[model samples]
Target: MTGPRSARSGFSLVELIVILALSTIVMGGLTSVLVRQQRFYRGTADLIETRSQIRQAAGIIPSDLRGVSTAGGDIIAISDTSMLFRATIGQALACAPVPLANRIDIPPLTLANKNTLASFSMTPGLGDTVFVYHDGATEAAGDDVWVPYGITGAPTMSSVSCGDLIGSADLTTPRYSFPLASPLRADVTPGTPLRFVRRTRYTLFTASDGAWYLGYCSPDCAGSTPQPIAGPFLSGAGGTAGVAFTFRKADGAITAIPDSVAEVSIVVRGRTRGIVDMGGYKNTQVGDSLRFSVAIRNRK
Candidate 1:
């Protein structure tokens, strides 16, 4: 009925097969490139994280250790991987002394103008230690010393006139009264300086996920959960410690006694979270190690 059917204007079966084969090959190549790109990005992320962890450890650990005084009984315990010490957390001047009542009052921690002389990194609490500087000059020349006392209970905030130690404008400023485990010495008078300390420990510990981390324990480490400050570092395996602590004397000799330690060397080794491609079927975990020495500022 239509004057010889026109020839179909469509690809032949062989042409269709060839085009499909080419498309499949192109798609396969693209898929390969995408996968490689994804792997590269992931590997980069892991490396960055590893480096960040190492930096965190380097920054935080040194600051804490530098404040410790090896000769002053601040170092409670030390080992290859851990160290416990009394960390100074704050400094204040005694505004008033109630030695017989086993109490001492200091200027308010927070002032309206923020001009208060007392500064605390942490709130004073039970089990904290206070180092009161005794003006041995009050008794005899060259007899000055610091006396340590333990805090026994919660501190109370009360409005107390600090007299000349605080400005008259801040006369109504509240103060904190801390109860001590024992009575202060009779010589401890108003305006005496005080050092607040807390027991702190730093250690290398394995987390639940089988990764190593730098752990921070406050007050004490025994039976207390450590806060992870850094790492997924290299495990102490194959003759390498995850975290290593070396104590040195002033003359650079190794020391076992805490009081003899004048410097501390810290070595932290970090590793990538997963294996990274090194090209040509080679994949390995990237790692870095950092070593730094910290001079104990209060060692003398």
Candidate 2:
């Protein structure tokens, strides 16, 4: 039958074994490459996250500290890990003389469609403090200061027209009357400026996950819970601190007195939430840190 079909050609056993071995080697190399690439991408992501944490801490702290005044007692208290200060929330102009009563009036803070005669960053609320700029009668520079008054009750809307006092034609705009804890100085008259403030605190606090974070507490941190602003930062251990504050005087010397602090040095260290494989190391955590200083405003 066709000369015995010439030994039907096919791969021998040895040839099949060689082919399988080569395929296995190639697949192993490819898997190794894929593993390395995945590790690289993950490590890069962790590094970026760590840097973002540091930036978040940097953004809020400096801006808040820059608004504080050392000589004005804006820095209520300070320690290595925390600072309590008066944070300015809003500002407005007095439309009329402050009477010897427990109330003060500000011009229309918000007007519909019309130009606002007086504006506040936020509406004044109860328990907030207001600082009224006082121009002493004697014209002495030393005697001129900002007098503090506490708001006792909610602000009420009044139909009182501040157009005559503020020299604006918008008489229909209503005024906001804030009740005070006590009578203010009678000398606080028209054209005087006012600032609203709240006692705010910044501190490094431990979160529910057992990680440290930068926290912000307003009106004081004594009984109020702090809001986490940034971080799963490095834990404070072995002489390393997650956050530290150093107060410096004008001469650059460190000071413990809050009144003498002209500059504040802040150091924050951030850590990744998960372990990263990097540079042949496995299960390592990535970290980043930032150090900056802010000079207090209106430091006398």
Show the lowest summed lDDT stretch of 10 residues, model 2: 161-170
lDDT of 1 by residue, 197-266 (tens): 9999998888888888999988777897788899988776655677889999999998888888899999
Instruction: Look at candidate 2 and give me any clashing residue pairs.
Output: none
Local accuracy of candidate 2 as per-residue lDDT tens digits, 87-150: 8877777767545778777877665545554665566687789898999778778878888899
* C-alpha RMSD between model 1 and the true structure: 2.3
TM-score of each model, in listed order: 0.92, 0.85
Against the hidden true structure, what lDDT does model 1 obtain? 0.84
Q: Where is model 1 more than 4 Å wrong at Cα?
A: 138-142, 278-281
